[model samples]
Target: MLENTQISILGCGWLGFPLAKHFIAEKSTVKGSTTSADKVADLKNAGIQPYVFTLGANNNADVYRNFVAESDVLIINFPPKRVEHIETLYPAQIQEIASHIRFRQKVIFISSTSVYQNTNDWVTEDLVNQPEKASGKAILAAENILREKLQNRLTILRFAGLFGYDRAPGRFLANKKELSSANAPINMIHQDDCIRLISAVIRKNVWGEIINGCADVHPIRKRFYILAAKKLGLQPPEFKEETTVSFKKISNLKSKMLLQSTYKYPNPLVFVL
Candidate 1:
C-alpha cells in the first residue's frame, strides 16, 4: 500500500527502529530520528535515512518542520521521560510538530495504554481517557492537541506494554529475589505485533481514528513469567505480593474491524514459553 511514500519516524529507539525497518521493507522511504549521533549510523545501516534530533525543551523547530514537510506520513514515537513536567512539555512537543507540518499530511501518533486508568475493565477507543499519572496525562493532552490541529488527518494507536527480542518477560524476572503483582493480569503486546498493527494502518490509510493496539491473550503476571522461565531452564521467579493491581485490559477489535488486520503474535505468552 505504501509502495513509494516517504515515512518519517521521530524517535528511533526500541519501537522506532523496528518501525522504520518495517516501512522500508514495504518499499517506503524511511527516515528515522535519534537523539544520539552514535545511533545514526546504525539506522543508516538498516536502510533508513537517519536524523539526529530531539523534541521538547529548546527544540529546533526548523528541523521538525522540514522532516514533516518532506514525509507523506509522520509517526511520532517519542516518550516523555520527565514525568514531573510532562503536562507542559508533552503537549508542547506535539504542538511543535503540528505547527510545522501541513494539514494535508497524515500523522500517526504512537500513544500508550497507560493513558487508561486502572479500572479492571476492557478499554476501547470510545471510552474517554482518564490518565491517573503525569505520563498518561501528558499523552492524553498530546492526543488532544493532534486531534484539534490535524482533525481527521491524525490517527492514534494506544499500545500495551511492549516485549520482544532481548526484552522478553522471562529475562525481566530472571534471577529476581522478589517480584510484585505475581498474580496480576499482564496485558502486553509483542514488538512484532506492534509493527504489524502499524503496517496495517499505513496500508489501509486509516486516519482520524483512535485505535487500541494489543495482543489477544491476557495471562496472569506470575504464571506468565514462571512459564517463561521454565521454558528457558531458569528458576521461576518468586512473588512478594499476592494482591492484584487494578489495571485495564486493552481491546484490539477496532483495529481488526477497521483495517482487517491479523496479529502476527497474538499471544505474548507463547514467546515466553
Candidate 2:
C-alpha cells in the first residue's frame, strides 16, 4: 500500500534520516526536513526531497504546512532537547504542528517508553500517565496534543532505548563510578526492528492505536553494559551495590499483535555489532 505514497518526515535526524531512506527504497516519495541548512545536502544525497524547517509556537507555518500538504503520511520525529525548560517548549512546538495538519490525514507520532515510570512491573502502552522524567512528561504531553487534534488519524509508537550503529549505550558509562540501578531490567530496541515495526504499521494502515516497540529479552543493567563494553575492548563500567531495586520491563505484545512484528533482535544479549 505504500508504493506510490508520499511520506514526509519532520526532523530527519538519526532515526528519521534512515527511516526516510527506508521508505524511499520501498518506492515511496519521501520528503524530509532539517533545521540546519548544512544537512539539506545530505538528505538530498540520500534520495530524499529535502526542505528547511523550524518548528515552534511562532515559527513560520507555511513551510510546515506545505510539507504536510504534499505527503500522504506525516511522521512527527521531533524530539525535545535534554535541557532546562524543555518541558514547556516540547508541547508548544507540537501544538503548533498540530494546528497546521488536518484531521483527515495520517500522522505517526514518535514517543518514548520512558513515559512508564520505574514501577518494578511489566509495563504496556496503556501506562503512559506515569512519566518520571522531564523528557517523558514532554513526550506524553505531545502525544496527547496530537491525539486530540488528529483523533483517529494518529498512531503513537512508544519506542524503547534505541541502540544500533554508533549509538551503543555501553560506551556511554564506561568506567563510570557509583552507578545506581545496576539491577534494573533494561528495555531497549535495535534500530532495525524499529524501522520494520514502523514500516509494517504504515503498510497495514494501522491508526488510532498506541504500540510499544522493544525487544523481547530484559537483561539487567550491569550485565548488558559490561558485555557491551567488553565487545568493544572498552573498560567495563562499575556499579554500586544495590540496596534498593526499581525498574520496569516494557512489553511489546501490543506491537506484535497489532503491527504483526517479528523482531530481528529478539534476544538483546546476543545482539552483536
Candidate 3:
C-alpha cells in the first residue's frame, strides 16, 4: 500500500500536482516542491507539504536537503526547458538534483518517448534511441546521468505525447497550415493513465526498469486531430494528403504486462476535449 509512504515530487506542475492528490488520497505522505512561491499556498491548501525550491540556484541549503532526505521515494518530474545548449545544460541541471539524492534512495525519473527517433515503425523499449530534437536529446542525456548515479535504485518511465485534462489536442494544430505526415500515428496517453501507471510503479516496487507509458491504440494524426478539434468546436487544422507518411508507434506492451491495467482513454481519435 502507498499508505504512509514518504514521497517527494520535484516538480509539482500539471502531472505532478494530480499525482500528489492521488497519493494523498491513498494515505501517503506527500511533500511536493513548486518553483513558484505564488503556488505554494495552493499546494498547502490541498494538504501537500509544499516547498518553494529551485535547482542550480540561490536557496536555503537546509530546507532543500531536508526536503530530499525525508522522502522514501523521490520523483524527478521536471521537464527540461527548450533552450540552447540543452544537450549539456539539461544533464547538468539533473546532475545538481541527483547530487542532493542519497546514494541508496529510490528514484523515479519521468522521461519522454521523444528519446526514440521516428523510425516509421513500431518502437519498443529496447530499441536504440537516436533522437533528432534538442529536447529529446536532453531528456535522454538526463536519463543516462541518473542511471550512472542511481543504477538499480532508479525506475525510468518514458511517456508518449501527454494529453487529456487541461491539455487538449485541439489547441495543438488548430487552423494551422502546412502540417505534414497526415498518416503518421499519434502515440499519446492520458493524465489519468499516467497517474495510475506511476502509482503502480511505487505500489509494485518496480525498480531498475525502463517502462514505456502510452495508450493501446495508435490513431492517424490527421483523423485524430480533426476529430479532437471538432469536439472542442475549433477550426480543424489542414494537413497534406500523403499516400505514405513516416510514423513511429510507441509499443505499450511492457507497461501492460507490468501494470496489468487498461487505459481509460485508449484511442486518441476519441480523445474528448
Candidate 4:
C-alpha cells in the first residue's frame, strides 16, 4: 500500500476511473480530472477527488498546476481519439500538460500498440515504432515529448486493444461483413488486467520503463469475435477466408518479467463480462 501518497490522474474516463478507485481503496490520496461536468459527481461518488480538466488552448492552467503540485505521482491517461485532425489536437494537448508537470514527480503515460506498424510477427518493447495511422503517429509523438521532458521520471505503457467492461469485442464486429484480417491474431487485454498492471507499477514504484500491457493469448480474430458474439447472443460477424500480411502479435513478456509473479487475466479468451 502507498501510505500518505498523493496520486493525480489526468482523464478519468474508462480505464482511469477504475484505476483511481483501486488506489483510493489502498489508502492513497487520489485526485482525478474529467472533461465532463456530469462525471465530476461520479468520480466523487467513487471516492476520488474530482476536478474538471478540459483540454483546449484556453484551458484553465491553474487547475492543472494545482493538481500537479499536490501529487507525488501522476498518470497521464488521455489517449489520442481517432477523430478528424487528431494528429494535431492530440499532441498539442499532451504538450500543454507535460509543460506543467512539476519536477521529481513520477509519471506514467498510457500509450498504444498501434505505435507499431503491422509487423506480421511477434513484437516486444525493443521493436522499433513504425506507426501506420494518424492516431498512432500522434500518440508516438506525445510519447517522445514526455520522454524528452520528464526524462527518467516517466514510464510508458503501450496497451493493446482494450476490451472487457462495457467494451466487449463481441459487439464491435457483430454482423459486420467482408472484414479483413480474419486470421490476424487478436492482441487485447481485459480492463481488470489493465487496472492491475497500472496498480502494480505504482505500488512497486516501477519507473523509467516501457512496458506492454496485453494478454499472452493470441487467438485469431475470426474465431475470437465469433465466439464472443455467440456468447453474447449477438449476430456473429462474417470474415473472408483469407490471411493478411499486416498483423502483429504483441508479447507481454517484458511486463511479466518486470512485475514478477503477478498474473491477472493472462488469457483474454476466457474473459467474461
Question: Residue 5 CA error for candidate 1 (Å)?
Answer: 0.5
* Cα displacement (Å) at residue 236, model 4: 0.8
lDDT of 4 by residue, 128-171 (tens): 89899999999999999899998889999999989877998888
**Runs in model 2 with CA error above 4 Å?**
none
Candidate lDDT (C-alpha), each: 0.84, 0.87, 0.89, 0.86
Model 4 lowest lDDT segment of ten = 259-268
Q: Candidate 1, which ten residues in sequence have the lowest lDDT sum? A: 50-59
- Give one digit per residue, the lDDT tens place, for model 3 in 1-273: 899899999899999999999999999999999989999999999899998877767756776688898788999999888888888888988888788898668999999999999888889999998998999999999999999889999999999999878999888888988799998888899999999889999999899999998998888888888888888899999998778787799999998888777788787666653
Which lDDT tens digits does candidate 1 get at residues 19-49? Answer: 8988888899988888899997899899998
Q: Candidate 1: give its CA RMSD in angstroms.
A: 2.0
Of 2 and 3, the candidate ahead on lDDT is 3
Please list the residue runs of candidate 4 whose C-alpha ends up more than 4 Å from where it truly belongs after superposition: none
Structural similarity to truth (TM-score) of each candidate: 0.91, 0.96, 0.96, 0.96
Candidate 4 accuracy as lDDT = 0.86
Top-lDDT structure, candidate number: 3
Write candidate 2's Cα lDDT for 96-164 as tens digits: 877878647799998999788887899977764778899999998898899878888999999998898
- lDDT, candidate 2, equals 0.87
